[model samples]
Each structure stands twice: as structure tokens, then as C-alpha cells.
Target: MFKNILLLLCMTALSTPAFAQDHAAQNADIAPDMPAKFTVNTDKFDFIRRDVMIPMRDGAKLHTVILIPKSAHNAPILLTRTPYNATLMTSKAESGTMRSVLQGYDNMPDVIADGGYIRVVQDVRGKYGSEGQYVMNRPLRGALNHTKVDHSTDTWDTIEWLVHNLPQSNEKVGIIGVSYDGYTSLTALINPHPALKVSVPMNPMVDGWMGDDWFHNGAFREEMLSYIYNQDATAKKTAIWWGNQYDNYDLFLNSISAGALGKERGMEQIGFFRQLLAHPAYDSWWQQQAMDHVLADLPLKVPTLLVHSLWDQEDNYGAIALYYALKQKQADQPNLWLAMGPWNHGGEIKEASTLGPIKLPSDTGLYFRKKILEPFLAHYLKDDAVALPQRVSAYRSGSDDWETREALPARDCTTDCTTLHLTAKYQLAMNGSAETSGSVSYLSDPAHPVPYVQRPVITRGAANSAWDNWLSTDQRNAASRPDVATFTSPVLTQPVSLDGQPLVHLTATTSGTDGDFVVKLIDVYPDEVPEQRELGGYQLMVSSDILRGRYRKSFEHPEAIPANQAQLYQFRLPIMNHTFLPGHRIMVQVQSSWFPLYDRNPQTYVSSIFTAPPEAYKPATITIDTAKSWLTVHTADVATP
Candidate 1:
């Protein structure tokens, strides 16, 4: 029951903000008065919600809720597998909790009203109402030959039972969901059933360590600790606030270290939390847990629509990684496609037109639902002949235009892809003077780490929380911090466009053996914006990444940084398509820590950071050697519109 609440947390916050702008002319086809909520009144619709336990191949029964239209003969079945309990959709037992859970619950309510399909929502095995032992990202067992049971097998079994058992069902099944639910949809693609025609996995949690939900570049996400505690079967839901503390930045810091905080809250008893501490490095433990490794060899048989978001706070890289992997492996499977827009985690279901104070060109949420998602699924499920768009569909953040391609564009040449050297004077420039070889040093105190954003950092799982849009906030607060090294370039004379991943090559020396490097690529708006007056001098973070110093060589083999020695640390930031308009400046902010968001690295490298005592946390000085360090960016010349 608790799992259902956590699963729908972000989905609820995704729709809190209304589309405040008037884009009727821009989105002419989309209804101007489209309800702010992403749900339909169940009472107004003629459907019967039946709860039943579906038996799996392994004899494990799964709890499922079948919502069938009264006029359902010859209609197809639209199914969604979820860890979240399914009865919340139809039960009027607790109106208060039901209202809270379904605040922004998103589903094909329009399709339900149209009454052409029977909607099936079920709980995944071992979660909530389902019976079995729960395992996160249950590793795929290579192949299915009546050997072992995984999510894929469970999906196949469920679909097989539904097609044969349900009356008036045409035996056609389609799967769809978001976040954890999306993961289940993805699992259905591997060794799928014949009846599983289509699936859509939006911002799915594909991997634990590789920039999706849990860890980033092998660095543990401290902000998600509360979530880990919340999901523990034995533990109750965690309080949103940490004992009257307004700013999570301060609350997390006061706890000393992440492990210390977990211990204080008795989180170390949780199996998943304990496992995280056991395998700090990307060893076999994390390797098996990765979706890439699990589904690496399995060919995608079912046509899938991979959905991701531009500002997704959680699981940003998974769908993109999946899209790329599918492109190479399923080259002949032309049905594989990607659609990305300007939204946070699960924000695509909401008003995608605006993120925080920024406004997109149109209501991308409506456009995506009407033009892409609805049609793509309808074509396969209902045999509708409406054609889909190009394979790759992405929204350019600043440009405010959708760019579609048969395949992702390649990196530009040397002329267009420029390399800028970081200067000792805190300047980012194209030309470097060998004679002016210098380094800038700063004091990095674990006690007073750099805050990720100016606002008080809130836990992301809370409803209508500010955590979703923190990525879009200005970096003025962090740039002015003494621990952060700021490098600014001259105002751009011409518009510069970036179309690929931004690479950061750093040569730095740390006083201690273990630390972190957070590199941020920012777009500095002009000081005077006559039209949008408040947006003047806005420091919009375009791309950013973090790497643990110990993981410099390999994630599998973490070698501590040689103290006081300049070591080269190379890593790529998340890929993004954005433009630096004329009169704007490009800035880079490098820091040793991003507090609360990431665990504070105890400068001294120890055998186990989790067991390291509070004394291990100490102050250290980090130097950025400009002579040997540079930031390279992949850019494209202005193309004709």
C-alpha cells in the first residue's frame, strides 16, 4: 500500500502547476479548456472495476484490477503493470487517501471514455498486494527456456491468462506506464508474448548506478536516502520534513555523513540500503543490477516508444541510453522510437509548456499526447493506420522547436566543435597562452559544502515539491561560493549551438585522497531583457555532471587519487540540445561538492566510506591546474531553417 503512494509521488507533482500562458493560437488543435488534471471522473464513465488475483507461472498470484467498459465486446485490452497498488483507481473506501493518491494520476482517461478497450492495472509480483519476495530491478536470467522467472516471464504469464480468460477480449494487449511502471513495460519487450502488441516506457528506471534514479557516475545520491527508507517493507513512510528543519541542505549536513544518517534512522537494516553500502564500487553487485547488462543480448521483439524528459530530475539517462542501445542492436526493428521534451520526471504527463519560470514554445504535453503517444499506441492496438513521426523526436530547450531525425545527428567537425581552455584568471577562452600556466586553489570543507541550488533543497518524493525544477534554477548562489571555481567567457558575438554531449577534462590535485568534481555548463543571459524583464542575467544550467575522485580510472576498479598530484579526470556531461543566443555568455562552475544532492566525500579515502567514522570527514584544499585542464564541447554551425 505504501509502495503505491511512493510510486505516484512524482506523477502527482508533475501537474501541480497550470499552463499559465495563453498558447491557444500555438496549440490550436489541443482543447484550450483541457482539464488541468490528467484524469477522468470514474463516476461519469460506465465501467466496472473488478479486483482479482491472477496466477503466475511460478504459482505466485498477483493482485490485479480489471476496469472494463460496459459496452466492451470485441474491444482490445490495455494493460499496465505496477508496483503501486491497483485498487486505488476504483475503490471509494477512503476518499481522502484516494484523492491524495490520484491528485495528478495520469492515464488514458480519454480512451476509457471512448469505450474501445478494457483497461487492466495489476501489481507486479512481490510488491504491494502481490505475493512473492521483492527484488529491485530483478536481474534478467539470460534466456527463458522454462528455467527461471523474471519480470518478463511474469508479463507473459499475465497476458496469456488474460487473453484466454477474459470474455469479449480480442486477445490484443498493449502495455504502458511511467517511472517504475515504465520499467515493467520495458521488461515486457524482452521475450514478449504474441499478444503484447505495443508498449511505452516513459522516464523508466533502467539502471541503478548509471544516472538513473539512484546513483550518478558511481556517486551515491544522498537526496534519495529518504526514498530508500520509505520503500523498506518494514519501515513506515518517512516524514517529509526532517524535525522542523526548513532546509534539507542543513538537515543532511547536520547528520554528518550519509551512512551516519542512515544508521541514526535505522536504514542500515533495509536490504537495499545495506547493499548500497556493501558495494560502493561498480562491481559485480551493480553490474548484475544494471538493465543494460540484463537486456544486452535480448533482441527487442515488441515495438516500443521510449519517452524521456529534458529536465527530468530522476531517471534522465535511462531512456536515452535505451534508445541508443536499441538503435545499434535493433537496427532492423524500425518500430523503436524516442520522444523527449522539456519536463521533469514524469512531467511529460503534465503541462510540458513551462518549467519553473521558463516557458516553452507550446504546450508540449498536449502536443505529445495528441500527435505522438495516442496515435502510436492506437495504430498498433486498434489497427489504426495513422502514421507516426520520425524515429528520433527531441525538443531544443532554448530554441523552442521540435527536431526530428531518422537517426541522431553525428558530432560536428573541429571548426564547429570548439575546445575552450580553463584559465587561471577564471576565464573560459578559445585561445590559451602556454606562458600563463597557473592554477587556482580553494578550501573544500565537508562541513560547509556547496548547496546544489539557492532554494532550500526538498526531498523529491513529496507532492508539489520544488525538487523537480531545481535543475532549471540559476547558479548565481553556487557561482559566488568560495569552494566553487567560476570560469566565464566573453559575451557571444554570434549564436552558438550545442547538439551533443559536453566533455569535461580536468587536471586537478587534492589535499586528500578522495573527493568529487562537479562541473556545470551554464548559459548566462544578457543583463537587459526588454521583453522578459525578470529573465535578465539568468544563469540557466544547460549541462552538468559529477565524478567521484576514487572512480577516476574505472568504476569497477576505484583507485584513490594520489594526493597533491595532478591527475586527469575525464567524463562526459549529459547530452543536451541548446543554443547560446547572441549577447549571451557561456560559463563553467567547477566545485568539489554538491551538498545534500550527493553524499559528502570524506576527503580521506578509506576501505569503506559507509563504515568510516565521523573523524574521517576533514577539510582539504583542491587546485584546478588550468595549463593541463580544458573543457571540450560538441557544437554545430547554424543550419538553415
Candidate 2:
């Protein structure tokens, strides 16, 4: 009966006049009349924009964008090669002014406009508008990468083209960028082109395994999965990881292990994700890609400026590590310089007068651009430009001032390091020993790991997310946790300043076969603030780091930690030039897990934490021997302005 009714309806619809006309219209052939291309006239603009594809050593052609000022003649070329879209970076706003068009990442608009530089931005090979295969932080042409081409070769070819093709260029080029673009700038230093005069690598990704975007001291940064999925899954970054809920902490906590979450999210399709799972430990694969180690052996020809941020949430280790690595070989080479600012990742380009609740005396980003960056670039890329005086420009927090010195640590605190001992009574001491040789124990459950930030944790890159400045946030959230052990010092009688990396020496024991340890050094504010009332009693994190127990002895090798046995673990935290002002107290908190930010340790002995099963996650008792543990902080008597 249904088939008969359907046949009768179809026959009645076929007989209708409207249905017949619609069918005839669908069958009719319409001529295609769209234009093949469109043109953009920029004659009235202050700068002439050109889009071209520059060929690499291989057959790949990278998309390049060049912006020349209206009166540009013999101007220095400032190049920035990035995986990010060049078109977006160059054309940020639709305006007649050149500064309006180039106002995004890596382009200091005021400085660029004032310096009269021939600006150039390009898409790295295999990214947007570039033709080639994409590899995540592609290793140099070596054992890890069997291919003959790499970022260095591509940068060299790009510089060669820029010098020959542009008549307005002065034949001198300076490369500057932040993060991944900074990494590309470092690549150019390996075998620099003759035209390349200066290189500014600001917050670069030097080592992913040690302390960078990917991992920190053998702990996998699981939150970076979203970045890898979005970046490597597609050429134009169309693949975005959207969480079903608002809180990323709950989303990650419910997803079991990082490996399981990746599988559920279809991250198995990304080559970098597969590589990450395969190499859980620091092996040749990661060691070969470490730029600091790679550049240590190479000759330093270009005048390179290493820019670092005190509160950089990403790539914080790159600039500092590379600075030290290059300093080891800087006896005769005086071309290397270092600049440390009070900003977050890429915050040097933005208005850095304030970071989170902390306020600076001035716009530190603008100060750096005008005083340090502009002068350095002009001296190298232009003719008869005055040379910069200082080799190191470090911004000292707490005092809210900038210091120019000949070398870092300004003054060496190696032999005069201040040692803060942890006591059994939960106090930090400068001279006294432990009142009792007792130990502090806490339950570390994989099921209820401590959140890295406050509740309702949002994913990185999300709108209004605090991922960029979480390091500078208040640490009272973690200190209040029962699972975390806190040690506090009395209010400072005088100002105490730290000039170098703080060394963490811990003697700990875990009931489970394996575990992890996170140590944070924080600055506690006074109970009353006259200026910013909300900042009263604020606890700001100064320096912190984590160490995986399995790789405590060797980063390259992994072993099961002996259960219920005391073992010593030592590692250096990030460098800091902060001061504990008068009336401020210093606090240190120790915990087992920094979850969702880093993958849960499971607390059980597993060959690879990435592939650990649910059964491996067991609650374990962690003990800290207060008598044996102490934090070694380098103290410097910085001369305040």
C-alpha cells in the first residue's frame, strides 16, 4: 500500500507544471562567466606591496611578501620567514599607511616605519602558499632527516633572491622573529648568507625535549596536543581541536592518558604525534634537533641578538640556553648579545607595561624596540649607524628597572650563592638546619592530579585564556592544596635579588615504582598594598621546573625508580633576575604532578608513560626529606637606577 501511494505521489509531482519547469531549469546548460582573476590597485598606498613565489633548492616555491616604502631607496631588508601565513602578517589592516598594513607578529610598526626598512615576510616551505612537505621543526639535513633540504637552505635561498631581485634593497638583510620564526632565524646562523648581517631570535624553540614547547625535563606537555593537531593536520591550519566542555582541566582529566586522548581525537593521522609517541624518552631523535647543541660547534659569524622573556610561557628555555651555549665559545667573538625583558611569550612586541596583575614602570616592549632593537638593526643593516654600547640588556623585576651590563649575572654569584634549606616545620631558612630529621609525605593520586592553573582551566590560544601569562599568576591556588607541600620564609629584612638560574636539589621517595617532582619558587607579597589593593598578599611564581623520576639519572635512558627508597634528584630551574623586595616573603612549593599541562605520571613503573594503561595509574605516597633538600639561588647585588 505504501509503494502504491509513493508511485501515485511521484506521478502527480512529475505531471505538475512547477516540477516540470524546475527539472527543465536544472537540465539547462548555463555558460560559465566568472572572471579568471581579480586585481588589487595599491597606487594610493604609502608602500608598494608585491607577492611572489621564491624557489628553493628543491623544486618547492615559497610564498613571499615584500613591502617597500614610497621613498624606499637603498633601504635595508628585514626578512622574517615563518610557517604562519605571510599574507596575514603583511596585510593585517586595510589602510593607506604602511604601518597599518604591517602591524602584526615580528613587525615592529613604529620602528619599521621610522627606520625606512624594506619589509619582507615569507611562508616557509610546505606551509601556506608554499609547495613542499611539512615537517614539525624539521631537523637539519642529517641522520634524523634523510632529505637534502632544510630550513637553513631555504633561508639562504630566500636571502639570495631578495638581494638580487629588489633594486631598492641595500644588499644587507636582518632576520628577526619570535618562536618558530625565531627558530628559522637561528637556522640562518648555521651557514649564513653574505647579505645576512644581523639575526634576532626572540623566544625561539631551541630544544623541544629539554625545555621548550613540547616537553620540560622528560615530562610531556600534553596540552600541546591541540597545537600539533591544528598545525600538522592541515596546511592552512583548518583542523582545530574544539573541546566539548568549557573547562580543559575536566576534559583532559576525563580522557585517561594523553595517548588515549590523541587516539580518540584522531591525532594518529599527524606524523609529529606518531613520532612523539614512538620516542617517549630523550633519544637521538630529539637530541639532534636541539639548536643549542647544533650551534655550539658552528662558527659565529653573524651578529646575533638573543631575546628572552622573564615570564615567557612558551619557548622560555630557548633564548637563555642558546645564550649560554654560544657564550661558552664567545672568547674572541664579541658579536653575540643577549636581551632579557619582563614579558611573556612574544610579549616583547606587544604593550608589555603590564603582565597579569604585575605592573611595570613603563612600556617595556616599546623601550626595547626603540633603545635596543632599532639601534642594533640600524648598526648592522644600515651605513654609518652608531654601535650599541652594552652587550647585555636585562630587565630586573621587583625593582622595576632596566640594567645594561657587559655580561649576564652582571656579577658572578657562583661561589657566593645563597642556599635556602627546607625545614621540617614547613619554613625556609637561610642558616639554621632542620629542627627534626622528619620527612613530609603527601598522597599523589593519578585520578586527582593537581591543576597547573586555577579552576576552569582553559586551553591555550583560546580567547581570553591565561596560558600566555599563567607563569606570572598567583601561586596561592597550588599552595593551598593539601597534596602540595609549601615552605615559606619570613618577610625580607632587606631586598634579596636572584641573578641566575636556581638549582633544585631534592631527596625524595615514592611508594610507587615511578613518580614526578615539581618545584616552584615564588615571591609572596605583603599583606597590605596601598597602591593596588587587589595585589595585596599576591603570590607570584618566580622560577619553577619539573623532573621525571625515571630519567633522573640519565635523560637518554629510563629506569624504574626503586620504590620506598630515598634518592637524590637535581635540576636547574629557569633563569631569573628578580628581587624579593623589603616586606616580601619567599615561598617554595613542591608537588608530584602538574596535570593536564603535563601528562599524569600514573605513579607506576611503565616502559612508556604515553602508552601506560589505566591499571598502571595507582595512588602513591611521596615523601620529601626536608633535611637533605635545599634550593641554591644565585644572589647578586644589582645596582638599582
Please report, in order, the local distance difference test score of every candidate based on alpha carbons: 0.77, 0.89
Predicted candidate 2: what Cα RMSD to the true structure? 3.3
Candidate 2 C-alpha lDDT tens digits along 432-547: 64363678889999999999988788999998777988999888889888899999998888898877888888999999999999999999999998888888999998889899
Candidate 2: stretches off by over 4 Å: 1-36, 410-413, 433-436
- C-alpha positional error of residue 462 in candidate 1 after TM-score superposition, expressed in Å: 3.8
Please give the lDDT score for candidate 1: 0.77
Local error of candidate 1 at residue 380 (angstroms)? 1.6
lDDT tens digits, residues 169-219, model 1?
888898988888889888888889999998889889888787887788877
Please tell me which predicted candidate would have the highest TM-score against the true structure: 2
TM-score (C-alpha, index-matched) for candidate 2: 0.94
